[model samples]
Target chain A: MDGIIEKAISLRFEIAAVILFGIGFINLLLQSNLIKKIVAFNVMDSSVFLFLASQGYIEGRMAPIVTNGVTDAANYVNPIPAGLVLTGIVVSVSVSAFFLALVQRLYKHYHTVDFDEIMMLAKERVE
Target chain B: MKKDMWKRFSAWVNGTSEERGPLELPDTAVHHEKKKLFELSDEQKIRLFKAGYLAVAAVVCLAVVSVLLYTVFQLPLFGDPNNPAVNDVVERYVEKGLEETGAVNMVAGMIIDYRSFDNFVESSVLFLAVTSVMMLLLRDKNNISREEDIQEEHERIIEKEASDLILQKVVSMVLPCIMLFGVYVVLNGHISPGGGFSGGAVMGAGLILYASAFGTDKVRELFNMKTFKTVTSTALLCYAASKAYSFYTGANGLHTGIPLGTPGAIFSSGLILVLDICVGMVVACTMYGFYVLFARGEI
Candidate 1:
């Protein structure tokens, strides 16, 4: 592989993350489907993780482990972001889990998961 | 052209109600009603209050911006009096801790010693979140699964079809293998990157498979809601009780607890076993919650 292209390939995850976020954001704004919007929210969250992990990447770095159980900082990337990512992953999962429950509740209450149907139902419920 | 004009004119003459959509209010005296110009409901009034607060906040922000601009040329306000010196001392302490522990995982030392209590608290938080979700969604599945199981079993047994045969054979073949893998992951959590949570999820996946393959009826009969709740709660309580013992007695963790045991050895972290079981239970319960809701055709 070309040197420049290899560097870009290493950054491909961050690029894909941004692209997914943008796509999901546009779809969220344009689409009237509630399920799709929820899915878009999740995609946006995932994009952050992708960007984060990419930012932590370094050329010719070892995994965040000690070489032969000795303190050698020469080959290791920062582990703070990875630890932070673990926390973020947990938060993301919890948010998705709760959101899915709410979606279930919404579907049960409103006959359809479509945004327009939900709005119509809300208007009816209000009256 | 005259006839076409006449037809269009007639429609216009009728005021084009047909052309207008249903939501379009008719411009007629009968449609008019006496109503308040700003009769806000309770929720709307609260929203209006929030809007007012936001406007106030905007003004405050602008005021702060002006103040900051006015003070731009001043030295850094509240500059740390002992900044570099304090950091120099702190770094030395951290370096000493790292050297003494002989564990290259600096973060682990920071986590276990400096902020171990915080981790215990955080673990409790996760346990709470898991428990809350289980408590909320579990009730529906417990009752519904039984009825669904019975209905499905009758259908599968009575039918002598190729698809049924295929599904039965597939499920029977795969369930044992998945279960074994899940157990392997859980048991050897301390040895590798894989741990209780991932292993538990894999185990739960096996149940999901069993449910999907053999039918919900068979799964309900085999596992049931009661079994899940009992085992899950029991597992969590047992984990908490052990932790309580450590907290009270200071007996120094469950595993072979000496100097991280030649790092990457199977018996490294003393707490890994405890961590594994807790993670496994959490994953299993969450997976079961998903399977139950989804199998109801709610998805």
Candidate 2:
């Protein structure tokens, strides 16, 4: 437990990210509002990005941008994580847009954005 | 007497007669009995299930978070250079990226040059999302109801008549600066931290501001469905073509004759700059398109 506490102190960013992920997960599970669910999904994505970015950081190193023609590997943090985070961000945005669009359609059809209400209405229609 | 009778007839015709008995509804005792027999228990069951589900979800979420936190403890220390992720691939990209990709922004070089296909696919995903959204939300004769049409028409009139003076004045001054900044970001992406995606987003935001201030009709004059389709498709096609060429040449070990001009220059990085422009265009179009489609269900 002492070692774990020491490590957690060192990896506070990761801990925060994990906590954020949990918050988003719980909200996603509990929230019935479609928009809130999308927001939670984005929160989860942001947490993952935070974790990935933290992993990429190296002490006293600059960003991946080459300055003054310095091409040394030791001078920069990991560029791969930045690139991955960029990809993740774009994908998440796309997913969010698609999800919101679907919700809008649901709102149009059922006149409600409540996930459970929509489900109930859809079932009622089917029956 | 005749006048009174005529007045009573008119009141009856207009549904103003007050003398009426209680509405005769069917026997609801059976329904009440049925509800008592089944619905009450069903409602209780649903409520119980919902509460139980939430409790379980909370427990699961806590468990997951704890497990993840524990896993984090097992991982290497944060900001440690000797971590396993800082491997040969990263080393090569950091050291040789400038010379090979001719991009001062190593992230730009890595994304648009080294892993251009992935970036291309990312752009495609954005394009696909906008397309799907348009398919779902675009107002057409088939999907639009009469009331919705009237409501939209009324909104357009309101937008036209109630154009806020302050917004117009402020946006007019700021819009040009925003457009310039967005263009600057896109143009300087290779030399700086800002690249296609961020720059495109900035430009799209400017377009949105302009639309919101001046109304969609004005924006439509310059950027309509045809313009959106043309710009996005052209950008995507250009990106695919250039990336495909580079991939083919690299595979065949043949010189593609594309000059990797000196790094840190505005017009350098071979195809990275061009690819960045293409991506910026696509992203800008997509952003504005999404706004227009969502707001007016057209565009």
Who wins the lDDT comparison?
2
- Displacement of residue A93 (Cα, Å) in model 2 is 0.9
Mark the regions of model 2 whose C-alpha exceeds 4 Å error after superposition.
Answer: A1-3, B1-28
Model 1 chain A scores worst on lDDT over the 10 consecutive residues at A70-79
Instruction: Provide per-model DockQ scores.
Output: 0.17, 0.78
lDDT of each: 0.57, 0.91
What is the overall TM-score of model 1 with all chains considered together? 0.62
| Superposition error at B19 for model 1 (Å) | 28
Task: For model 1, state the Cα shift of residue B64 in Å.
Answer: 23
Please write out the lDDT profile of model 2 over residues B115-169, one tens digit for every residue: 9999999999999999999998999866788877899999999999999999999
Residue B119 Cα positional deviation in candidate 1, in Å, after optimal superposition? 6.7
Itemize residue pairs with steric clashes in candidate 1. B149-B217
Cα deviation of B57 in candidate 2 (Å)?
1.0
Evaluated on CA atoms against the true complex, candidate 2 attains a DockQ of: 0.78
